[model samples]
Target: MITATDFITIPYTSDLTQAGIAYACRSLPYTYDRMGGSHFNRLRRIVVGVAVELAFRRRLAEEKVPHDNLGSTPFTDPDRYDIAIGGRRCDIKSFMLTRRSLIRHVSREPQALLGADALVPSDQIVSDHLNDEDLYIFAFITALTTPNQRSLDRALKADQPIYLIHPLPKEWAHPSRWIPLGTLALKCDTSHAVTLELGGQNESRAFMAEEIVLEPRKRAAAESDFYALGYLHTSNPPDGIVGVHSPSVGETHLVEPIQWGNIWIYGMQIIFTGYMTRGEFRQRGNRLPAGSRVFKYSSTRTENRSLPIAELHPLSDLFTQAKKWAKRGA
Candidate 1:
C-alpha cells in the first residue's frame, strides 16, 4: 500500500517490499508528459514482485510447503522469511513474469549491514542478505516490454502488459550460471539478523553483523571510460536491442545502438539484419527517409572493430562519427 506523498521521496533501499511500494506510489498512471520516469519504472518492478510472491505462496502451499511473505511487513523493520514444504526453513525467491528464481546483485558500497567484509567509514552497512544462499527452490517472472519507451507508453495506455520470462541470459558467459532473478530471501541463523560469511575460494571465515562496518574507496582517476554500443546482425534476436529515438514530428532521429539493450547485456543473440523502429527512424529526420519510416540495416562482424558504426551504412563515416561524438556530450 503506497501513499500519495511517498511519490515525493526517491526511496533507495535494498528491501524488496519497501522499494516496490515506493516505486508504485511514485510512478503509476504513467503518461509520457507527467514525468517521474524512475518512479514509474519502480512501480512496474513492484507490481511484478507482488505477483511473484503470491505465486510462490500458492505453489508452496500445494506442496504443503511453508512460506511467508516477508515483503508484507513494515517499512522500518526487516521481515524474516522461510520457505518450506512442511513448515521447513527453506530459502526461496518468487518471480512473476518468467520461471521461478531470484538474482541478487552484490557490490561493496561505502557502508552497509550484513557483509563479511567491513563496509568501511560510513556509519551504515548495506550488505546483501541473500548474497550466497541455497534455496529450497527459486523462480522468475519476467515482464517484457516494447523496444522503446514510446511504444511501451502506447501499450500501457491501451492496458496491454508485455514481458518475457526465461531461465538465463541467452548465449553469454555462463548462461545457466547467470540467473537474473531479484533478491527473494536470505537464510539466517537463530537470530533474525542475517549471517555473514567470508572466504576467498575454498576455506571459509565468518563474521557477526555487529562486529564490522564496510565502506567503499573513491574510484581511481581514469582518462576516459568509453561506452561502446554493440548490436547483433539480425532484427529479432533472443536478447532484443534498445535504441533511443524522439517521436516529435520535426526532430531528427538520433537512433543510437545500445551497448546492452534493456539491462541484460550478456549473451544476447541477434541475426544479420539490423532492426530499426518506425518511431526511431522518424526522430533522425534527415538521416532516415521521410516515407520510409522503418530501416533495417545489417553489418558484418569485423575482426577488430571500433564501434557498431558499420550498421548505419548509408550515412557518411564522418556523420556517424559526429553522432557518436555528440552522444558523448563532446
Candidate 2:
C-alpha cells in the first residue's frame, strides 16, 4: 500500500517551462507522426511532458545527485530514458490533474494530491512503444489555475538542430521525419491523415508522413493550467524544494539543496508520486487491450499495459537508494 510519504514534490519553474517549450519547437522537426491525435495536440503534450522531465532533472541537480546529461545529438531522440540515477535509467510519466479532480480535493493549499487512479497511457505500453528503462517515474501537475500558453511561432528554425524527439537518427532503419509542425496542410482519406503541402520551405527533404496527424492550430502548448507557488534560492522556508510526506499526507520541506538554477514552477506544483522498476512493471502491469478504458473514457484508442499509481515505490526511496550508490562513486 503506497502512502503519501511515498510522493516527492519538485518545483516546476518558469525557466524550465520556457525551456520545455523551446525544446518542443526544437524537436518538432524530427518528431514522429503519432497515431490518433493532431500534430498540435502531440506538440502540446510534448511541451508539458518535456517540462515534467526537466523539472525532475532540476530537482536531482539541486539535490546534488550525480547523473548523466539528457541531451542527444540532432536526429537522435534521447528522451526515452529521461534520466540516470546511480547508473539506473529512469523514464518519466506525467499527467495534469483534471479541473474536476482539483475541485474535488485540491485547493489553494490542499494536502498532497493522491492521484491513485492515475495511469500510463495505452500507446506508451503497447508492444511496439513499450519503455525499457530501469524505472518508470510518475508525476502529477496541479490544476489549481489555468496555465498560460506558449506558442512555437519561431521556436523551430530551418537550421536549428533537433534533439530528443525520436530515439534513433535518420541513419537508423526507422526514421522520424522532420516537418514544419503547424505548417502542414493535411486531409483525411480512409482513416489516414495525408499531408498535401507545407506552409514553409523547411528544406526537410520534402518529407511528409502518411500517418494521420491533425495539424494543431498552435504548434506548442498555449499554457499548462496552474497556479503559482512561492520559490526562493536559499536554505530557508521559502527554500524552493518541498516534499509531500506519506502516512501524514502533509507537505513539508525536504532539503536546502545546493540549487543554483531559478528552478521556478512559475505558479505550479509538481509532485512525483512514485516509480516502478522495469521488472515490477512487467510483473504487475495490467494488460490494457486496444479500445479498452484507460482513464474515464469508454475506450482507449490503442492497446496498452499499465500499473496503478498507488502501487508504486516512493520517489524518496529511489533517492535513498541512489544516495547509497552516490556515496560510493557516481
Candidate 3:
C-alpha cells in the first residue's frame, strides 16, 4: 500500500511542493528566496540535518538500517575533534548552496585539491576507500538555493564548483551529486562530538563552541512555539528545565524556557502575579491571592470578591486543531 508515509521518498520539483514537504518535515517557518547569505545558509544546513535525522529515526523504528544526527560538527576542519564512532573518528560537514561556489573558487589555490580531496572526499571516492564499516562520510544537504525564478536562474547558471572530484577514478563509475536522495542516504554520526573552528583572514569563530554536539539536542515539539518567550524574561532560567503548560490557542501547551519576572496568565486574564518557576515552569511558585475579577470579557464582576469562569471551549478547540496540524505536518 502506498501510504502517506511513502511520500517520504518523493523528490520535490516545485516551490510549493518543496515548501510543503519541508514544512511537513519540520514546522519551522520558511521564507522563499528571502533568507539567504551566511546565516540562512547555515540555517538551511541545520534544518536539513534535522529533517534527515528525523527520517532516519522513523526508518530505524521500522527496523531499517540505524543512524543518528551528527551534532554541531563541521566535517571539513581537521583540528576540530569529534568523538570516535565505532572506533573511527568522523566529522560532519553541512554542504549547502553557496558551499559549491566557495569550494570552486578556493580549489584553484595551490594544494587545494589535495586538501579538498583528503578532507571532503566525494561519495563515490569514499565508497571505494571505505568498506561497509570503515568510512568517514560527509552529510550533505541540497537545499534549494533560490525559490524564485530570478534566484533559481542565477544559481543554476552560476559556475560554482559542484564537482569536488574529477572524472571518477575508473574504480568507481558513479558520482554523488548534491541531490535530495543523497541527503537521505547520509546520516549524522551521533556518537561523535562536534567542533567548529573559524580562523582565516576574517579571524572569528563562526559557530559558537556551545552550539556543536553529536546528538543535536532539539527543543521538544510541545515547547517549540513557546521557547521564544524565554528571552524576554529578566533572568534566564537554567537549561534543561522542562517548561510549564500555559493557555495558548486553546488547551494548556508547553512554554519554552521561562525568564523570571513575568505575570502568569490563565487565558488572557492575569490570574496570578509571581516569578514563573525559578528555572523552569515545572518549578513550583506561590500563587497570588485571588481577587475579584478585574476586567470583563464575558462576565463582569459586581464586587471585588466574585470571580467569573473564562470561556475556554473555543480556545480549547483551537488548541486541539493546532496540535492536529502539527501531527499532520510531520
Q: For each predicted model, how many residue pairs clash, with residues at least 3 apart or on different chains?
A: 52, 21, 6
The estimated TM-scores of all candidates read 0.26, 0.56, 0.22
Off by over 4 Å in 1: 1-37, 66-71, 76-91, 94-136, 146-148, 156-330
Which residue pairs in candidate 3 have backbone atoms (N, alpha carbon, C) closer than 3 angstroms, thus clashing?
70-188, 72-212, 75-92, 75-93, 83-193, 250-315
lDDT of 3: 0.24
Report the lDDT of model 3 for residue 21: 28
Pick by lDDT: which candidate is best? Answer: 2
Candidate 2 stretches with Cα past 4 Å from truth are 33-35, 73-79, 98-104, 107-115, 121-133, 143-267, 292-299
lDDT of 3 by residue, 1-330 (tens): 111111122122233223322322121122222223332232344344334433323433454222233353332231322322233333332223234454344223312221221112122222332233322222222234442335533543664211100111111111122111110011122233222111111112121111112122332122121211111111122232222222321222222322111111001000110111112211221222223222211221121111111101121232244355446655
lDDT of 2 by residue, 113-150 (tens): 44344455445554443345467787777632212211
The candidate with the higher lDDT, 1 or 2, is 2
Q: Model 3, 5: alpha-carbon shift in Å?
A: 28
Q: What is the C-alpha RMSD of each candidate to the true structure, in Å?
A: 27.9, 18.1, 30.3
Q: How good is model 3 by TM-score?
A: 0.22
Where does the lowest 10-residue lDDT sum fall in candidate 3?
A: 265-274
